[model samples]
Structure formats: structure tokens, C-alpha cells
Target: MSRDWTSTLVRARSAQDGGDLALAARLLADAGGDPTAPDDALRLLSGVLRAQGRHAEALPLLETLTRRRPTSAVAEHNLAAALGDCGRAGDSEQAAERALTKGGAAPETWLVLGRARTSQGKLAQAEDAFRQALAQRPDFLPAYRDLAQLLWMQDGDLTRMTQAVAPLAALAGVREDAALLYATILRDTAGDGAALQSLAAWVERGSVEAALAAAAAASGLDPRLALQHAQRAQAQAPHDQRARLAVLTALIAAGRAELATAGLEDHLRRDPGDQHARALLLTAWRLVDDPRALTTEDYARLVRTYRLAEDDAADRGAWLARTAAALRRLHPFRSHPFQQSIQHGAQSMIDPRAAGDPDIDRLFEALRAPIDAYIADVRPGGLAPTAGGWSMSGAWSVKLKAGGLHTDHVHPRAWVSSAAYIETPPTVEAGGHEGWLRFGAARIGAAFALPAQHWVRPEPGTLVLFPSYLWHGTEPFSGSGERLTVAFDLQPA
Candidate 1:
């Protein structure tokens, strides 16, 4: 352990350069325990630990490095980032501020500060930090992406989202997700043809991310063009599942689902819990009236509603009021967030399960019985639902204002999906059908464009559960105070 630290660090760096993180970690661990170990060894070891998601193991080393190099901006910045990763957002903010105070004006340092602020729910400060970072380094694509994401979530203004990152659409090395976001915003504002054309310049330059973006934009515009870009992207990055998904989407769009059917089915066979693949395969089969697809669309068998049971001793009214208040505080945004169906509303990004509210915590406790009953009792299709196990995958609360509605869509990645009402506006309480949930329609233009076959009215403290493939939406209400609800998706555990 007390061997020459310098030589060990050199070998570790070489290992790290050769992409042998395990070897580098081993070499550094041998010396990292010694107080006489060089700063280089501890730093490299911390990096390896972080890369491997061993954040707890890395934190102590990072703390030690920060203490030893108190005046070093890079040391402070690294600790800030590591602290953010370890969920100490307040500590991260302090460390990042210290780094900046130490004359570290690097764009990376600003980005770290932005991320720390974001972790603490300081969206405005995070947005400012990202803007400052971008101003310092205009070619910093990460800044563009972070800023765009923050603005989009804040206002849901597609125009602002475009203005935030469109300047960098011509730059190299933008995040793949950022490219897709830009394309999606364009598609929303200017239509699929314009969206596809927007990325053509970059796609023509052999950028895989751009090609993938163009593929998404061209999904409904030109099937052949979408397939071409997606195939090109897949060829460049054979292991990227996103590219493969693009190819599959294009195949379905091109009416050549036959070519993609075997692989999708084989993948589902190997991993039967892959509901996303199942959804795609179902879509493909529905194109040709495959019996397998028809069975899954049995709305009556798959969709059901549950009324939360309340005992005489339970203070149901007060509990719902508290839960609604908790949810209301979370919806600070001006409009709905990205890639969601909620329109003319604001949705909560915080996961209610971990929001640390007593009433919200009890909401899950209330749902457990109904969810269990639904899973065990409901017979989906002609048989039963298939899954290895079941658990909630993600959850969010939506607060829809007047004229708010949800467009028809399916949850491809979920085996089960749900919406639980916390509060309903006066319109719904009046026995009116406005703002009612409608099911059994694929709004996506296709051969099987079915009108909504069933409708469910929302009531306070009631939950509706349905198969993920069931297309559902909400009708816009005329005069409404607000409609508040929480929804979650379930997948095989």
C-alpha cells in the first residue's frame, strides 16, 4: 500500500486511457488508502468509482482531494459534480460556488453549478447558470441542451425550445436527446416535412445523431426517407437501441412490418416483459388483421375503474384536500412538460412516491388494494395479463386548466397504466361528459383508425386502469376551474 504512488498513477492513467476502468480502479485502490498517495491516484480512483456508479465509494476520496487542493478550481468543481451525483444538492451548490469564487470560470464549472441548482429545484438559477455557460462557450452543446430542457419544462413553449437550441443545430457534438428534442419541437410547430427538412443539412454531413433526428421527423412524412436515415444511423451505431427503434418505426411506417416482425417477436420471446416491443409488434400485426393483435384490443376486458375504499373512521375529505394541496405546489410550470399528452396545463415532474408528503404517501397505500385486486381479478384479452412481476415504473401529477385535454395515445413501455383523480372541476361534478376519459382510438393515422369506443367519467378518489396498448385521451371542457389528477405506468418488475 505504501509503494511508489507516482508510478502506480502513471500505470493507472495508461489503463484508463486503454479503457480498462477495472484495472485502473484496482491500481488506484492499492495506493489510495495510503496518506502518502499522490493526488493523481485519488482523483483517478474517484473517477473510476463514479463511472461505475459507486458514488459512495468515490465521495470520501473526492472530499479528501478537495481538502488537499483547497485552492484548486478543478478539485472544487469535481467535488461539486460528485456531490450532485451523490444527491447532496445543497452541498453541491456550495462547492460549485466556491469553485467559481476560486476563479474557475470554465463553462464546465458553470454547467456543474447549473446541474446542482437544478437538483435543488432552483430552475431559474439553473437556467441563468446554463445561459452564462453558453455565453462563455457558444459551441458548448451541453449548455444548449440543458437550457432548452429547462425552458421547455418551464413554459412548454415550443417556440422557446426552438430558439434555445436551434442556433446550435448546426454545431457538432450535441446530445442525441437534444437533437431529438429539436426535431420534435419542429414537428409540432412546422409539421413533419419541415421538421425533417430542418435536420437535412446536418444529416447530409454524416452526423449519426442528425440522421436519427431526421428519421424521427420523417416518420410520417416519407417512410422511405425515414427508413434510409434510420438504417444509416443503425449502421453507424449498431448497438444503439434508439437507432434500432427508429428502424422499427420506419419499417412500420413503410408498410414493410413483415421484415421487422421476426426480430421483434424473437426479442419478445427472449424477454417477454418488453412491453415496448410488444406494442410495436401489435401495431404491425394490426395492419394485417392478425388475430393476436385483435385479442389484446378487448377494451371491456382490459379497462376498468376502481373507487378507493374509505372506512367510517377515515377522514377522506381532509385527506384528498391535503393530497391535492401537495400536488398543487408541485405544478409551478406555465404549461405541460415534454413528450406528454397533457395540453393547456402544467404537470408535476416530482415523483409523488418520494415527494415526502404524508397525504401523498398514504395515496399509494390506498391504491395498493385496488391495484392488487385489478391485477389478480381482471382477465385481459381471452386469457390473463402476462408479466414476470409488476411495479410502478414512473408517476406524475397533472393539473389541467380550463380548456385542457389529452390527445389519444398509447403507453408503449408500460404493461399497465393508470390515472387517479384527486380533484375534478365543477363541470365534471355536474354529470357532464366534458373532460371525460375516452378509450379505443389510435389518433396516429393508420389503417385501423378506430373511434373511441368507450368513455369513463372521472370522480374524486377514483382510479382508472387499462392495458398500456389501449389508446386513451380526454375531451376538452368548456368552463372549468381546474382538473387535477395523478397518473403512473406499471411494467414487469
Candidate 2:
């Protein structure tokens, strides 16, 4: 390269490193037409633009760069990412596939392809791609994390997911991501105790100590330890939001609601737009029944998003009747092992605290009535019932046998949602009968408390309601029989 070009490149690189993305783009543009001039420069500029969330601008530049250098895997990958960010999953997958083809299926290429496929909801295909990436390059940390997530989504054993990522945990630049993934795996598999232990260790020893500590506390793990780590992290990096959130979360989780409320108010005073802090604050106030401090708008939004309805009865009942009748006709419900799996998935065989005595069908019917009534009460004219109070709609049922469990997750689109228990085993394992409902902290602007709040020890006859966006899940059953439940969602209508 010419001295002038080299000099211009250095200045552009400097500007990018300095975070002056616009300046870097302008400088790169001025470097002007060597045959390579600007394509190389534009590629770098594209990356900077992407980092700045200007994905539209980045896509064309990266696409042109990849077209010019058809074998450039990095260019292709960046283009695919830009496209995916813009919601063009099909285009992203095509670009990712081309990159993988040209690059001979390297792990990075496969990683991109897997991500693209995942965005398109080709989960099985995505899992295969991720597994293939790992098979080709076992040390590829990204693939491990990606595959673990896919497995988790499939509701595979949490321990297996953790084991999958364990090998990559020590890899450079992967420690934090791996730790977070591992923490999630532990949370789902071993319950809060294990998750709390892992989170505490990460807070004490990891590079993302503050974030880990905050996340741990938010998840209802060792608040004192998390708070200690948060204090240390803040002492070292006073301006870090991660540290502040961690401290705030620890306070919340520890049930120090008053302090958490005060601390959040002070923090928000300094940073008015802190949405996370605000959300925590709302949750804290709600917990304490301090209605005056709550954000009416946020609560309204949450209710409007996750409430369920009674009119849903006809549709849900019809589907249930059809499914049950079909199962009865198919005789799968009579088969020992397949029936076992269904019963296990439905959690019908276990009895948790406050376990209500209701037949699965009866409970479902009862639950539907209230939901339908609520929908009629709130739904605007001309809309339909969706899964989670969104415009979309869906419903499903399951039968869980002994030892069955559901992992944590949120209903993405539905406004109102619920699960109605139908069957409970006559007996349960010691400590197994505590099947309880849990909800995560609302994502809002202020800090309320730490340990993203959870409600435990739910009764079987009792129906609990909350926002759709709130992350929630079920506890494992230790009973010897089957547990049955029908879970449903309602869209915006």
C-alpha cells in the first residue's frame, strides 16, 4: 500500500478506536479511489457503523465488500449479521450459507449460519449447524454457548447443557459468556441454590463481577455476597451501571425494600433515563404494597400485555376435547411409556404445597372462564385472543409424569397467560411438593430491590396473574404419579 493510504488507514483505525465512528467513516471516505481504496476502508467503516447500530448503512457497504471479494468470509459474516439485525432472516441465512461455503465450514462460519437459522426459527436446523460447528472445532467457545442455548430451548437436561459448555469456559474472551450460560444452566437444573452458589462465585472471581453479582442477586441468589462484590466493583469503577444495579438488586433481593427504594431514587436522580432501575423500583413498590410510589403507566402496560380471558373457553375447550379425544382414539394415553412421558411433562404426578385438587380438564375449564371473562372485559373491538396479550395467538397442553420440570422463560407476544393444574399425584418426594410459580423482575427504569422478585408456594386451586414479559417457570415434581396442566396464551384482542 502507498504511504498516503497507510497513513489514512492509521488515522481511520485511530478514529474508530477512539469511538468517533462518524469521523472514522468520513476519513475513510476521503481516502479516495485506489482500486482497493475505500472497499477496505469501507469494510472497516461498516463495522464501526454496525457497532453504532446503523445497520442499514452497514449492510450495503459490507455486501459490496463481500461481492467484490467473494472469498472474504469476514465480509460475508458481517453482511449476514447486518441483514439479520435488520430482520431479513432469509437474506441473512443465504449470506451466511455463502460465507460458510466459501470458507469451508469453519466454526465461525457455522456459528453465523446457526444464528441466522435460529433467527428464522429453524431451531432443529440451527441445532444441527451448531453441533456440526462443535464437531469440527470442539474448542469453538461460541458454538458451545450457542448449542447449549439451543439444547436449553428444546428443554433438554440442564446438566447436559452445562456440560456442553464446560470445555469452552476457560477459553480466552469466553469466560464471562460461558459463566453466564453456566449460571443459567444451573438455575434451570439445580434450582436457586445451585444458581446462587454459582453466581456468588462468579461475582467474587469473574471479570464481569458486577454484572454477575447483580444478575445473581436479581435471580434471588446470595444477596449479601452479591452486595459485597458489587461494593468492591463500584469502589473500583464508580460509574459502572453494572455495579450500581448489582448493589440495588442485592438490596431488593434481601428484602431491604425501603433502602432499595431510597437507593434507586438517588441513582435515578443522577441518571434519569435508567429504565432497569425504574423497573426494579416498580417491582419493589408492588411487593411492599406502596401504591403511591408505583408507576401507574408501567403497571397498566404490564397488565394490558399479559392478561387472559374467558371467551377463550370455547376455543380452548374445543382444542382440548379434540386433543384428548384424539389421544384416546390413538391409544397413546394407554401406552405405558409414552403416557409416562406425557404425564411427566404435565407434572400431574406430583403434589406441591398448596396443591389444589382439580381434574386437569376441570381446572382448565375453570381457568378458561376467568380468562374469557377478563378478555371480554378488556379486549378492544375487532381484535382476537393471542397467547400473551399480543396480536398473535396460540395454546397447548401437556402431561408431566413424576420428576418432570419446566424451565424458566417468558411468553414473548401474548398479553394474558396462565397454566391450570388438572392432576396431582397422591404422594410426592420429600421437598418435592413445593411446586411454586415464579416471576422475574419487570424490565423498567428504576431500581426497586435485588433478586428479581419471585412468588413461591403457589396453591393448585389458586390462579396467579402477572405480566407476560415477566420470566417464569415451574419447579420439578418428585411425586410418583402424573401431573397434568393446560397452559394457554391470549393475544392483544
Candidate 3:
């Protein structure tokens, strides 16, 4: 009996190390058929499930184990992680605190607490938690990467971001994320040349993670090399979604949309529930100029709702004027950061309180009806292309002053993208078709001409929705007044 139990444990460990998660889970779950054993097979199974992003499924198991061993810090830590994944941030924070007090000191415990704090918008607390993780394990690459990412995302400060990750770059067993962050920051702040050089140097190391990062970075700087690296990553990790998506995205960027279309179709055949792939396919079809991609029916569903106000011109003008003033006061950027390099003028960062204003909140509420209608009309069969059903993913407002314009771009992570005009300058309405939203433009660096197939004039209170993959931007206009609009991206719920 002792030998049998040992055999099961060894086999389970071997399977997990070999990346056979299903086999490892089965072996662990069946170990002695008793979760109360010292080995704790149930906890192991829950960990495996959580790693696979099955947090909801793993929660009950974690909860059961935590109840059985209430003082076990390991159980509490895992529970906190699962709760965080489920968006129960408050509960996760409490559990994390309990784990820290009960469990022996562990860097991962601190990391989880940091993540919980970050989710709650407690930036300073999160930073301190991550620092505690680093203090516990100096060479903890994940903690360094997280710290760097948080710093960068907060203020877009390259110096502070670099300082956060500099120690880990030269550390042994360094992960790909650190290198990727460094390279991305260089590309954004310095130039593509510097970024590509950094990526190439890492690729020379020949690690799979390095190849994956290089593939992503090369997509913009060198598409041919990106495709090669992506193919290598795919071959190295056949089951990895990162490699597969890189291949698909590289194909599209390289102007091989036909290949991208075929690749996505094959991928969907294998994993039909891959929302990201489904979303990419929409872009692929559009890139290939497939008529079925965004049809007249799709356009009909685009502007489904307009904000209701008194029909009187004075009332509408007053509202637009007030909103524009509010937006100007909230503009967050002087020049667009590299992440949003397409903007020729000031563009705001993702505001944590964007929809908090009563007016803004009401606008979002008003827009929901059309969003639901659009989703219903598009997914008539009730089959969502992605994993989640349908929901708004992110939203931010942009205020473009005179000479301000948006360069053509696609929202890769969004299933649907939208723009709701709040204010438009007189120059936009008076003529040269300036400051109008145009769609169907080819993605940058594509080896083909794809001009704007359609455009819509901005009107206060009117909202426009389109597939996220479609390339769109606003024409530059010469005007002293600012053009204010709120934009958002949506994913499956």
C-alpha cells in the first residue's frame, strides 16, 4: 500500500512536470481516494485546475480543502487566488491577509496579496505588497515583472519602469516577461530599432519564451522574421495558445490575411470556443476584403442608439458645450504614448473613474440597449465567437484639439469597438469631411492598398459600433475647438 501511494505521487509529479495537466490532475485526484491524507491530493488537483484558468471549477475544491484544514496557509493562499480570479477582490484580500498570518512566510503569498490589492485599485498598497515579495525572494522574476508592469501602466514613466525591472534582467533563470517589458518600453520611448536589437539579442539565447517574445516584437519591426519565430514557437510548444495566436497575428501583419483566415478557420475547427481566435478571424476576413465580413446589415446595426435629449437646438448645444468643457479638463496626455502612438494629439489614459460621472454613466447606460441589440443581431444563433458571452471590456474618452487626429488601428482584444461623439468642432461639421470616422483602411505595413470604404460624420450623442478587427481612425481637422468623444471595446460576456 505504501509503494502504491508513492507510485501514484511520483507519477502525478512526472505528469505535471511533463505538462500533461489532465493526467496529473486525474492521478492526484485519485491518490488514495482520500483528500484528508497528509499528501493532500485534492489541493494539488485544485492547483492544476487553477493553472489551466478553470478558477470557477477549482473554487469548490479549494473551499472544501480550506474548510478541512482551516489553519493551512497553503489552502488559504490558493483560495485567495481563486477568489481573485472570480473578481471577488474583497474576499480575496481578506483571505490573503489570513494566509499571511497563518501560513509560513512565502513570496507567493505576498504576490497574491499584491494582486488582490491591485484589483481593488489600491496602487500604493499593491506596490508595497510586491516589494515584500521581492524582499522575501530577491530573484523572484514574477514580482519584478509585476512591479515593472504596474509602474509603467500607472504613469507611462519609462525611467521608473526601467528601474523596477533592471535588477531582474541580469539575474539567472530570468523569465521572458522582464525582457519583453524592457524591449517594449524601449520601442515605445526610444524607437523600434533599439527594441528590435534587444529582442534579437534575447532570441539568440534560444529559449522558447525568448522566441515567443521575439516573435511578438518582430511582428511590427520585421514581419518575415516574426512569422519564422512564431512558427518556431508553435513547433516548440504545439499546445500553447500564445504561439498559435502569434502565428495568426504575424500572418495578418505580414499582409498574408488569406493565410491568417485559413489558419484561424483550422484553429476554430480544433478549438471552437477560442474567443480570441474567433475575434481575429473577423479581422482576417476584413483584411482579405471578404464581402461577408462587414456587410450592409452590419452597418444597419451600427448606430442603434442615440442619446435622448430635448429636440430643441439650444438644449442640445448647452449639453454638448458642458460635456466638451468637462472632457478638456480631463485630458490625460500631452502627446500619445507609444502604446497609442496613432494619436496625433492628446489622448487620455484608461480612466479608473471614466464612467463614474453621472453624465458619463448615463451615456454608458443609454448605449447598453444598442450594444445588446447589436450582439443579438450578430449572434442570432446565440453562439458567441469568444469564451465570454458579451460585455464591455474597456472604455476611455479622447479629446482631440486642433490638428489632432487618430491613426488607423484595430482593437485586437475587443470583439466590438465603438465611438460616441459628445462634441465636434464647427470645422468638422462645416466641411472638408475632416474629423470624420473612416473604416476599412488597411492595417499599417500591409503590402496592399485598402482605402476607407465608408465614413460617418460626428454628431453629439450619436454612437457607432463596429467589429473590433476593422481598421478605423479619424481624419485630421484644423480647428481651435476640441472634438470630444468616448470610445470603448467589448468582448463576449
Candidate 4:
């Protein structure tokens, strides 16, 4: 490389290292536009854009690079990731397929394909892709993590996930990722206690301690300890956003709203539209009764993005029938007002701890075992109460509507809570009806900060379990038919 090009690369690297993504982007752009700049410079620039969450801006550059170097698997993979981030799933899948064709089944390529399929709601296909990636490279940590997560979502089996990645925990190079993933899986599966122990062990590794600390902070644990660990990480890489976000969120959860406010303001001053900062700010405001309200357009936009529905009458009828059947099986008591309210679209059931049908008890036991195991393994000593003996106590319903939407809310007394989709309406609008489930918000309390608010689009076999107190609500259905979901809750035994 020429001296000027070398200098440009060095400057860009420094800016990126310092977490000055804007500066890095500007410098990279200047160098990239230079006809004499090396290909490496362009590649590095694309990576910086992606890390900074500017996938849209990075797409054309990555695309052009891939075109110029048709055999460049890295560029193609990057392009695929950018495309997926931009919500162009078909294009992303095609790009991944092309990369795999050229690279001959590389783990990275498979990982990209798996993620793309996941975003497209092709979970089965995505699982296969992830498995394919792992088959190619058994030690591929990312694929393992992703696959484990997918499995956890589907079956709520934390032990299986831990066993799947156990080989990684002892490998020095991959140990940190393994520890983090293991801790996360444990935290989510078993409870918070196991997660905390795993996290502590991960921190002891000395590499990426800051990242782990940040994760700890984000999980709403002791920020001071997390910050101390994060400081170690920042020493090596000053601008790690994951670390920063973790610390910032920890501070907010720790009730240091002033520090969080100042930190967020400073962050926004540098990048006014930082979504992470914006999310933190929203969370901080939740602590105080700040009446800064969201407009109708804001709610509408959120609803449209997350809701699911169908257009055909046949689809609607099918959905209702499936949902009704699930409800009847779950709740057979006719005299009960909650169960009697079963209609075409909505119905509720009551399963009390003290007294409930044997069938209902068995059904809840089946659901609780896997979930409890997962919570025990993942969350460990976290606040998740062991409700294995607890019967399904609270009553909830399946609400279906052609375009019905539910505003965000959290369950109050229920311990383990869930929503199982009996039927999904066909795709409609620009996409299919989203009417999916979304959970996580700081306003729900410190316990929810770690999950970082995730959206799961419901499918026929989709069943999501979370802490009842976690603030969650459904997006509206927009297709021509009703969406069907069965909601239930568990109480202390």
C-alpha cells in the first residue's frame, strides 16, 4: 500500500478503536474514494459501517466490493449481513447462497444464511442452516450460540444447549464466547444464580472482561463491579459499544439516572440519532413520571412493524378453529365465566394452584419443567421463582381480530407466563400480519433490562415463556383474518 493509503487506514483504525465511528466513517470514505487506496481500506470501511449499525450505508460499498472481487467470500458474507439488517431477506439469502457456493460451505457463510432465514421467520430452515454451519466447523462458536438460542426458543431446553456448547468452554480461544453464551443460556433457562456464577468465571478469563462486565451491567446487576471489569476492557478497546451500553444501562438501573442522563446526552451530542442512547433515554424517563408522550404515528409505526394477520376468509376460519381447540383443551370448565367467555376470537381460563383439573395440572407441568430448567440454568440465582409446584392460576385469553392491536402491558402477579400461538394469519400488507409478541422495557423494572426488549412473531407452534412481570404486549393484526394465541400464567406453588 502507498504511504497515504497506509496513513488513511491507520487513522481510520484509530478512530474506530476509539469508538469514534463517525470519524472512522468519514476517514474511510475519503480514503475509499481515492483511486489509489488499497482494497483492504474499503473492506475495513465497510466493517466499520456495519459495526456502527449503518448497514444501509454500508450495503452499496460492500456490494460493489463483492462485484469487483467475485471470489471474495468475506465481502459477499458482509453484504449478506448488511442486506439482512436492511430487511431485504430474499436478497440477503441469495447473497449468502452465492457466498456459500463460492466459499464451499464455510461456517461464516452458513451463519449468514441462518440469520437471514431467521429474520424471514423461517425458523426450521434457519435451524438447518445453523446446523450446516456447525457441521462444517464443529468449533464455530457463533453458529453454536445462534443454534442454541433457536433451540431454547423452540423447546425451552437449556441443558441441551449447554451440552451442545460444552466443548467450547474449555478452549482458551473460544472460552469467553462460550462462557457468555453458557451464562446467558443458564440465566435464561435455570435462573439468575447460575448465570451470575458463569459470568464471574467468564470475567476471570481476563480477556474481554470488560465486555462481560458490560453484559453484567446490562443484566441489571452491580454496575460498580461491571464498570470495574469494563474499565479493563476499555483499556484495550476504548470504543466498544456493547460495553458502553451495558455500563450505561447498568447505571440507569442502579438508579443513577443523573449519570445516565449526562452520559446519554454526551453520547447523543456526538451522534444525535444513536438508537441505543435513545432507548436508554426512554428507559431513564420511565423511572421518572416524565409525560413525554408518543404520538399516534409512533404507535402506528410500531404496530405495523410487529403485528401479524392474514387476508383470506379460509385462513381466518382455520386460525379461529385451531385457537378454539387449544383453548377448549386447556380449559374445559363450562360454568367458569373465564372459560365460558370463549368466543370466535377470544377466551380465558383459570388454573388455580390449590385446585385445578388433573389434565390442566399435567399440561402446566409439561410446560413448566423445560422452562424451569432453562431459567435455572440461564438465570440461576436471578429473581425467577421456582414455580414447578405452582399450578396455572391466572386466567388469560386468546384475542383474535382482523386488525386488533394490544397496547404494551405487563402481567402483575403471575410468575411464569407465556403466549402460545395456535394459528397465524397469512401475510398481508407489504408483509404478512405481524401481530407478534414484544417484551422487555426498563419501565418494567431492572429485571427486564438484560433481555433488551425482543420481538417474536408468533407462528402456529410458537410458544414464548418469560417472567410474568416482564412488560409485554402484542402487535395488531392487519390481514383479513383473526390471529389466534393462547395466553396463560403460573403462580407460586
Candidate with the greatest TM-score versus the true structure? 1
**Residue 381 alpha-carbon offset, candidate 3, angstroms:** 7.7
Model 4 residue runs over 4 Å out of place are 1-11, 30-38, 158-163, 166-176, 197-493
Q: How does residue 350 of candidate 1 score in lDDT?
A: 60
Residue 197 displacement (Å), model 3: 2.2
Candidate with the larger lDDT of 1 and 3: 1
Candidate 3: TM-score? 0.64
Per-model C-alpha RMSD: 5.9, 11.8, 7.3, 17.0
lDDT of 3 by residue, 186-242 (tens): 666555666667766667776677778677666666778888998888888888878
Q: Candidate 1 on 1-493: residue-level lDDT in tens?
A: 4588778888889998999999999888855568888787888899998996677689889889989988988999988888776656678889999999999999988998897776557898999999899888987867876777678767666777777776676553344554555666656545678767767667877778888878766665667878899999999899877788778767876778777777678767876665556667866777666787645346667788898748553578788888999888766676655467776777775667756789898898898887777787774322344654467767888888778989777776677889999998878766767878887555542222455667889988899998786778997887847788999987555
Provide the lDDT at 126 for model 2. 87
Query: Poorest 10 consecutive residues of model 3 by lDDT?
Result: 347-356
Ranking by lDDT: 1, 3, 4, 2
Question: Between 2 and 3, whose lDDT is larger?
Answer: 3
Error of 1 at 357 (Å): 3.3
Whole-model Cα lDDT of every candidate shown, in order = 0.76, 0.56, 0.70, 0.59
Question: What clash count goes with each model?
Answer: 0, 66, 7, 38
TM per prediction: 0.72, 0.55, 0.64, 0.47
